[model samples]
Target: METGAVDEASIDSLTDFYLGCGVDGMTILGIMGEANKLTGEEARAVASRILKRVDGRVPVVVGVSSPGLDNLSSLARFAMDEGAAGVMVAPTPGPAVEDRVRGYFHQVCEALGPDVPICLQDYPQTTGVPISVETILTLTRDCPQIVMLKHEDAPGLRKVSAVRNRSGTSETPRLSILCGNGGLYLPQELARGADGAMTGFAYPEMLVEVVATHQAGDVERAEDVFDAYLPILRYEQQPGYGLAVRKAVLKHRGAIACAATRAPGPRLDATDEAELMRLIARTEDKVKELSHGS
Candidate 1:
C-alpha cells in the first residue's frame, strides 16, 4: 500500500500474474489474501477492485466472513454485485455446537437470499468450529445455495468420502469439494474424491499442475512433479509466517512490487529470506529436470 492506501497497480499486476499462472479460478479476501485485516468497507472496495480487474476472466470467490452477520451480508452482496462468481463464509469461532453451526449458516443463507452461491469455508483449525460430516451433509442437503465446500480439515479424507458418497447418490445435488490447508494433502484429498484444490499456495502453478496431472489419470507423475516443488511448498506453509513467505516469493517473481506485509503481519528475517531464495532456485532446477525427462 502506498501511504496506507490500496495499491491498485500492484493488485492489477498481481491479478494478471495469477491469470498467467493458469489458475482456473481465483479466491480473493481469503486467509492468504489478508481479508481479516481489512475493515468491511476496505474489504468490499478491494473486492470491487479485484473483480473489476478480473472482469469475468475467471471465476472469483470472495471471502465475506465477518463477526457480524450484517457485515458479511453486505460484503457478499457487494461482491456479487461487482461480478464475483461466489462468496466463501467461514463460521465464527468458539464452541459453536453442531446445531448452532447449522443454524448460523441457515441464517446466512436466508440473509443472502437465493441468488448467491455459497462456498462453505470449513477450516476448523482456524475457525474453531468443527463441523461434523453429518452437519456438513445436512447443510448441503438442506441449503441449496451452499454449492461448494472448502474442505480444510486435517485427516478429512473420510469426510470427503462421506460427502461424495452421500451427495452423489442421494437426492441432493453435487457439492464441489476443493481441498485447502495450503494444499498439503492434495494428492490424498483428490484420491478421497475432492473435485479440486482451493488453497493459497505461493506457487499456484505447481498446485494447478498437480491437480491437472492427477485429473489426467497420471497420479504417480503428479506426485513426482509435486515432489519437485515440495521444498518450497512446505517452506511456505509455516503457520503464522506463511503469508510473508508467499508475498516475498511473489515479489521475487516480479508479480508484486513489495513483499511488505500489511500491519500486524509477519515479515521474513534475513535468514528466512536466504533460505527462500535457495528453495526457489532448487525448485526451478527440479522442475526443469522433470520437464526434460517428460
Candidate 2:
C-alpha cells in the first residue's frame, strides 16, 4: 500500500486531535495479552479495528511486541495488511539476550517484506533489553524496509548520533530517529538530529511548531517554544501520576471519552484532579498570552 496521499478527512481529524494536545504521532498499543494466548485471527481483528478507527489519517504506527518472532511477524503482517503507515517492533522485556533479540528482528524483516517499513523501538527502561548500535546498523543495512528508530533510551541523543555516524555516507541514510519521551527532551533531540518526535502529551501543536520552525531554519524560535512547554511536560513526568495527569488534561479540554485507564492504576483523586485543573488553567492562560504575542 502506498503511504502517499492519505485520506484527507482522516488526516484532518487526526491532526486536529494531535494539534489540540501537541503531539505529532500516536502509538496504538496492540491487542494487550500474551502472543500465544491470542489467536492469529483475533489479533488481526483487533489491529483492523484500530486501523479502521484511525481511518488512514495521520500515520498510524502499530506495535508488535510478542516474545517470539513468529507472533511478532504475525502482528507485523497483520498491521501491513490492515494499512498501517508503519509498524514498531518493540523488544520483549527480560535479561539481555542479544542473539535472541537479533533473530527476532531478522524474522520480522523477512515477514514484513521490503515494501512495508519497520521502526525499531529501543525502550530499555520498559523492555529491559537494549539494542546495541551495532545491531541497529546491521538491521538497517540488511533490511532496507527498516526505516525508523524510536529512541526511548535516556541520553537518547547519544544513541541517535551513534546510529547516524555508523550509517555514515551511505547513499541512503540508514534510519530516521524519532524522540519517544513525549516532549520531555524534544529540543535537545531535534538539535542532535532527530527527524521528529512521537510523544503522548497535551500539546502536539507545540511539537509541530517546534519541528516545523526548526526545519524552516528558526532553531531559536523552536527552542523558545520547547522551553515554554516545560511546565506541562514536567507535570506529566510526576511519579505515580503520569497517565492520569494526561487523561485529566485531555478530559478538561473536552477531547477524550473519560479519564479512565486500564485497571491496577489509581484514578486521579480529588487533590490530583484539583492540581491538574489548576495546571490546565495556567496553561490555557499561557497559551493565550503566547498567541497574542505571536
Candidate 3:
C-alpha cells in the first residue's frame, strides 16, 4: 500500500492480471493480503473494488475472519451484497479444546446464516487451534454451509487423505480440499487427494499448470514442473519476509506498480535482492530446460 492506504488501482490491475494468469477464483483480504493491517472500512473497500473489477469472471471469496462474530457476519453480508461467491472464516485463536473449537465454527456457520457458502480455514500455525479429522467431519455434517476446507496444517497430507477418503464415501458429503501454506506442500498434497491450491505465489500460472498437469494423469510431469520453481517457491514462503518477496516479484512481473508494502513491513536489502534475482533466473532456466526436455 502506498502512503499507508489501500491502492484501489493496484487492486484492479492485480485482479485483471490474475484473470490472465488463469486462476480459477480470487480471494481478497486473506491472510496474505494483510487483512489484520487494514481497518474495517479499508478492508471492505478493497473487497468491493476487487469484486466489481472481477464482475463475476471468476468466483471471489472474501476473507471475513474476525474475533467478534458480529463484525465477521457484518463484513460477510456486505461481501454477499457486493456479489461475492462465498466467504472464508478461520476460527480465532483461543482454547485448543475440541468442543470449544468445534462449537466456535458451529456458531460461525449460524452467524453466517444458511446461504453463504463457507470455506473453513484450518491454519493452526496462525490460529493456535488444532482441529482433528473427526472435528472437521462433525463440522461438515452439522453445517452444510461448509463446502470447502483451506487445509494448511503442516504434515497435513494424512489429514488430506482422511478428508478426501470420507468425502468420496456414500454417507459423507463432498467438500473442496484446497491446499494452502503458500503451496509449500502442493505436490504431496495433490497426491494425497487435494482438489486444488489456494495460496499466495508470485507465479500463479505455475500453480495452474501444476494442478492441470496432475489432473491429466501426468503426475510425474506435474512434480517435474513444480520442481522447476521450488527454489523460488520455498524462498517466497519464508514466515516473516515472504509477503515482501511476493510483492517484489509481482512488481517485477508487471502485476503491480510498486513493491512497497504498507508501513511497518519488510523491505529487501541489496543482498536479499541479489539472492532473489539469482533464484528467479535459475527458476527460469529450469523451466526452460523442462520444456525443452518435454
Error of 1 at 73 (Å): 0.6
- Residue-level lDDT of model 2, residues 11-123, one tens digit each, is 33444576455444656653221223335675566567657766665577877777677777777777877888888887777667787778777877787777878888888
TM-score on alpha carbons, each prediction = 0.97, 0.83, 0.98
What's the lDDT of the predicted structure labeled candidate 3?
Answer: 0.90
lDDT of 1 by residue, 12-129 (tens): 9999998899999999999766777777777878889989998998999999898899988988998998999989999988676998899999999999999999999998888888
RMSD to native for every prediction? 1.2, 6.3, 1.0
Task: Name the runs in model 2 displaced over 4 angstroms.
Answer: 1-16, 19-25, 30-46
By TM-score, the candidates rank as 3, 1, 2
Ranking by lDDT: 3, 1, 2
Q: What lDDT does the true structure give each of the candidates? A: 0.88, 0.71, 0.90
Ten residues in a row with the worst lDDT in model 1? Answer: 1-10
Q: Which pairs clash (backbone N, Cα, C closer than 3 Å) in model 3?
A: none
Question: Could you tell me the TM-score of candidate 3?
Answer: 0.98
The TM-score of predicted model 2 comes to 0.83
